[model samples]
Target: MAIHIIDEANRCLNCKKPKCMEGCPVHTPVPHIIQLFKEHQVMDAGRELFENNPMSLICSIVCNHEMQCAGNCVLGKKGSPVHFSSIETYISDMYLDRMKVKTAEQKKQNVAVIGAGPARMTVAVILAQNGYQVTIFEQQDKIGGIKQYGIPEFRLPKTILSRYQKKLLELGIRIRPNTAIGTTLTIEDLLRDGYASVFVGTGVWKARNLGIPGECLANVHFGIDYLANPSAYSLGEKVAVIGMGNAAMDVARTALRNGAHQVTMYARGRRIAASSHEMAYAELDGAEFVFGKAIERITEKGPVFKTSIMDENNRVTGYEEGEEQTEADSTIIAISQGPRNRLIRTTVGLEGSDKGLLIVDENHMTTRKGIFAAGDVVTGSKTVVHAVEAAKKAAEAMMRYMEKEGA
Candidate 1:
């Protein structure tokens, strides 16, 4: 593994104008990190990675390299791109344990972080490193929000998240597990208790329903809920997954792994929504994909899909006449998700979009003055790297706001 990583690192041309960095959502310094790795400055490479994006290791493992860094590589137009992900994983994983830095002088001001997802974790780390007393309020029993609950262990090992928890604690960030901010302790409550600034990174978890008949059936499940705990539900041999997004691919593959012999995915349009890489993995796992099927409703047998009429552009123009129901033991919906409104319903002056997403300004400050937000709650569901980018800006803004207010 080390030899392969070194070989990939050596392949980097270290472009004067790196397209790989430009393609990255958080603009990770790909060439510079590669240069550092080649120079034997491994720790420095990891430090640069973490400083630019706190969840560097996780992103390196999970981010769609074909669509981002690797895809944009100049060499990839002809040959395989330099696998920066492997090099990053090698450096970041090693540096995470040995990471120790002297923080600024401790301050009396406190900061409240709601949710322990990538965005909130970044905020908490930055706040703690800057001397503010940071406390994270996670609704779950542990941290890593989506990283812990949403992603399957096969893709990203749960042990990595456990290591992150240790690192966060070592940074002097206090974690309050199973304590939801909006339920008993409101955002107002945190402010009343003298929290200088509050950051809400509670990600989107509410599954968007298809609003069709038999959706509430016992045999049917939402993708997010199922991925959170696949062992809890017993999907039989014949499993049907609706939607062709990445989450749908995950559901199909996970179902196949958990004793489901026949797993099929139904797409509404002619083209699928999942990335080619994820789709290939799902296909390689013996999952079948059926496109041009617009779901009308679900039944006891399975999802009843109507033939989707497509235009010249392969867009779903409409649904055709007949409907067909495929036999399946269970059905899972992987359409998408929206933000939960627990905080919005409880907190006055907090504004949200029609889709129930929190409204945030350029600096990630919400409608409420001191309350800042980022991640899926603010920008809908996005990659971890995008959340990290937003969190960095929000953390800086929070520091400025607290300092100006003399909190």
Candidate 2:
């Protein structure tokens, strides 16, 4: 069923305005890149992609293209849309050299980037390209925070991260993996050690707690715990998921793959936080979707349910009484997350939200001078592309700040 994507590139109508580009958060010129690929200029195509999105190959592979570019494709009105992700993946992989930037203005300032997640990755690459020294401190041995840990291998393979790892290492961006910033070093330490500025993009690390009776039991697991190490974690045959989001969907699908005979997903909201396509994919993988009802409490036997009614505005009206108790061997709490704030609490003058998100001004600078933050640390669990865009904003802000300070 695999068509020669390069040949399929010729099918692009190549819209003048290019809604695909407009629809993209990063504003990648999709039609133009497709044109380059169709003409057999993969290197040229890669350069175009690199101008906007640095993680072209990985994003093309994992991004919800159907919701963005492919969805907006004019051809999608009637016929099939152009396979942009496949074409982009092809160009990025085949001509990676084109994505490499050989020249940047020697800014000569050391910047400390905490966490090796997508936001940090974007900031690191941009700052390094602009001739600033970037050092990333990751708590875990592996980089690519969410991409490396939270995601399932079936969706984004480990090989993709390995390729990116090699590329990042080659960029002369120093990385200290397996080193917790707050424990090993502090924000004051980075400044004292001559890092001109520090960017805190540690991301959302704390999983929301499910306040239920059986939460402390052996078979219960949080979304992060389940998704991070699916192989090592003890799974169950009849798995019950208690949320609806990207993480929730991932848990349900992952459970099905890892010997769970039946995966029952429960969420109270009318709307699922996850994209429809992702939910569909989970459903295709044999996950049982249960909406509008959720577990009020959990017991050793199973979950005690209450049917939640939603208004037209998607707000929960009230829970209808029901004696619904579904039997399951294991339960996974796949709810939202917040910033761990271990490093932030220790540091002085860094403002934060009620929900543990870091507070920043128009310039992406935190309450503390010489320190900036972006991504989920600021916005609380957003998509990878959104994180990248936010990083770009932070990077630009840093550039202006550094210029003012004459670093």
Candidate 3:
């Protein structure tokens, strides 16, 4: 059963400014939605939320609410603020089954949405509802890009993603799975055929490597490779994870659950890059952390690190003389991610950053006309909420472009 709505709804306070909304990346209407839930307008509340984010429940689960919406609550100044995201999530999960999304009767224009990730999914949902015939093209056989591949089952199960997929199909959005944009079909092919606009949300799947010795050892794995295919290989007992972010923590916890006896994480900086809650959970999960150590080299036996302090400039300072070695059968690097430019290189006139991130104007339009890009592909690795915000902005811009250049 869902939590009691009355107690939480009554605590909203419904301020005129609503700093919760202001702090939100997608600007979710917390106060107004709470007001609707308070009045027993259950379906109406969900609809109002979908008006902004189609994936409200998923966001509620993954989002760091204590840092964003709940952080800015006025009542938090005096006491504990209303758990807005949690309340919204409970109400949404309850009402989603009862509510049916009403899409446009007529589907006229066609828009090609590349990658079935969060950004593109948001774009497809918004465009399809507005009478644009949206078709999604995913390189992988399955949908839900990072949500399906990177996020663990404990965090977000595949069953929840399937529900979102069903809604998109019902909204008149078509999809072509196992079809890559560059290898199978190029963006020009879609434009030449009938698609009025092309939106690229293909995120970074390539993981960065630690340019050190013995990197080609047998059990080495990139963070994405390990997460994307859990059954690919046995991580083995005594695993070493490199980095200090959410991905690193997730990898450590995942390895621990997968029968790895001990998972230890190493970071160059003393500060934890991931959310404090996640780090706490990792610690509880029996994962060890060694900070202020830089990996000197990765030998077949394990990784050798040099103890040091990271300066304000991120340079190695206070370098210790001796080397510290951690014995491990496997090493998982979760350092960073760079954009894959295979598709962008094939599509002429689409400019990108030196880092290979797709370059876009204020309107989310790429260098090439009629082409737009968003998500991690456009801005490197960022939050899902930031990607959704960019995609929505792109959707609005496409709507204007569609009108100006009639399909």
Cα-based lDDT for every prediction: 0.92, 0.85, 0.86
Q: Write the per-residue lDDT of candidate 3 for residues 259-374, one digit (tens) a residue.
A: 99999999886876798878988999999988888899897778899988667866667778899877999999998788788877799898888888988999999999999989
lDDT sort, best first: 1, 3, 2
Candidates, ranked, TM-score: 1, 3, 2
* Colliding pairs, model 1: none
lDDT per residue for candidate 2 within 12-36, as digits (tens), equals 8888999888878898888888887
lDDT of the structure predicted as candidate 1: 0.92
Question: Which regions of candidate 2 fall more than 4 Å away from where they truly are?
Answer: 97-107, 310-315
Please give, for residues 58-103, the per-residue lDDT of candidate 1 as tens digits: 9999998998999999999999999899999999999988887657
Q: For model 3, what is the C-alpha lDDT against the true structure?
A: 0.86
Clash number for each model: 0, 0, 0
Better of 1 and 3 by TM-score: 1
lDDT of model 3, residue 30: 88
Clashing pairs in 3: none
